[model samples]
Target: MRIPSYEDMLAAHERIKPHIRRTPVRTSDYLNDLAGCDLYFKCENFQEPGAFKVRGAANAVFGLDDEQARKGVATHSSGNHASCLSFAAMRRGIPCNVVMPRTAPQAKKDTVARYGGRITECDPSTSSREAAFAKVQAETGGDFVHPYNDPRVIAGQGTCSREFMEQTDGLDMVVAPIGGGGMISGTCLTLSTLAPETKVIAAEPEQADDAYRSFKAGHIIADDAPKTIADGLLVPLKELTWHFVSNHVSEIYTASEQEIIDAMKLSWKHLRIVIEPSCAVPLAVILKNPDAFAGKRVGVVITGGNVDLDKLPWMQT
Candidate 1:
């Protein structure tokens, strides 16, 4: 697969602007005090589709010509990507076929279906998900929009950071939760060109820290169904995403499951905004390592808000 460049990101930004929201940037004084750093959150969760994935999905779906659009788009995602792609497809009046793990959050599955996407269930592992997606793709003949790996998707994701940079004067670091690396790759694609001095950092769950391990090993280290509260982040890095992660990402940090949950609660309590556990990983890691971010202006990507309302992780105990 080809790697997305800055130009592609610019084109993606323009293409997706009509379909996606220019999500707001929010700040929390409490969060800043707790982390000892200035925090500006790019509230992607406020998106109409409740996730940043919509930007990429809209970009990919809208970029397709009449021939490609006729058949529609297909992808495999843990949750947000599936729903967002479905929303994008719905906007363009096309079909969207999604292969998702049966174990994904019920809320996410419902969201996908609400947008008229056909769902194919699969086992939770990456291997099984891919196998199932392959069958679906072959049958549907839809344009494959790999959740994170495709160049179009990465370029689409890059728009988030471009918006972030414009909203904030500048930041010392831009931290986003890493799953398959689409959002982070997008961040890298934009910042590496747009704001070369701004560091792009990745936050991951310690339980599903394959990306971190891969970073240390200097290669892709995919996990097989690693469990974590950050369910949206269970997927591993692919070639296209690894390209940006290896080159442009400055650091990768991790937080334990409890830390993720605690941070989720903290954000809800202080920021007064709903956030998914996956999105909370950035704050979790920042709080866990305050000295690293002390006195710096940090831009945090609030990735999604599609949480299972009844099964809030913090409410379990």
Candidate 2:
């Protein structure tokens, strides 16, 4: 669990330039007026493979040599990371083995399959997924690309901040959702080094608040069952991420399920983007607490767009 440095992130941008998309930062006058702030959305949902996970996955896979790439790669992901890794593996002309929960969305699974990667379903528990992934690594001799805990992965994630900063001006705060903490950890590191005055805030779901709890407790907290519609945020925080977050982040806030659903619906109806629950978490925070960010320039990292189209979480039946 090593945190990536700003220099490492800059290098990662160079390494992954040809592979990952430098997605646009979009602004909405409607959202800005409602929140009382000038808001810029880093639309990673429009990113290649439809998520920011591609930045890390592509960097990790491409960083490997010909022989290492030939050995293939393995990881456990319930959603976006799997698709990104599959796409990365395809780029290298090697096989990608992804271990996912049996209950993962059909859309995500189909996307991974379309990218020419092999999928193995396992129980959703951390231990089970790890055991399954280890078996695949042993059997196929593939490199293990962790979803959010690796330094190279963190470095790749930091590039999002680089792109966001370049596309917008005068951001006072950048709010990003936290899961295993890869995105925020990398984002905070970049802001701390490049824009020290801009505070980084983490948006967590009330149902799965490991990062928030850990932030309040002043140490790494674990052993809590995650129960949230933001499935991507269910993973426990890693040591590297916890350290970076505690030192660099200004605060962490939690949003309820209904709040997330409202935000998701609003984004689709008003913003006209199909944002998943995890992607809606940051917007939920702003919607829930308007006083804090009112009249300030803020950046929201809209994480990904992968979702179950047949059964959307917020659409009333």
Which predicted model would earn the best TM-score? 1
Error of 1 at 174 (Å): 0.3
Every candidate's lDDT: 0.94, 0.88
Candidate 1 wrongly placed segments (more than 4 Å): none
Write down the worst ten-residue block by lDDT for model 1: 1-10
Clashes of 2: 1
| Candidate 2 least-lDDT 10 residues | 220-229
For all predictions, the C-alpha RMSD in Å is 0.7, 1.3
Cα error, residue 168 of model 2, in Å, equals 0.5
> Evaluated with lDDT, which candidate comes out highest?
1
Clashes of each: 0, 1
Q: After TM-score superposition, what is the CA distance of residue 231 in candidate 1 from its true location, in Å?
A: 0.7
lDDT tens digits, residue span 1-317, model 1:
77778999999988988888899999988889999999999999998889999988998999999998999999999999999999999999999999999999999999999999999999999999999999999999999998998999989999999989999988899999999999999999999988999999999999999999999999999998999989989999999899999998999999999999999999999889999999999999999999989999999999999999999997885
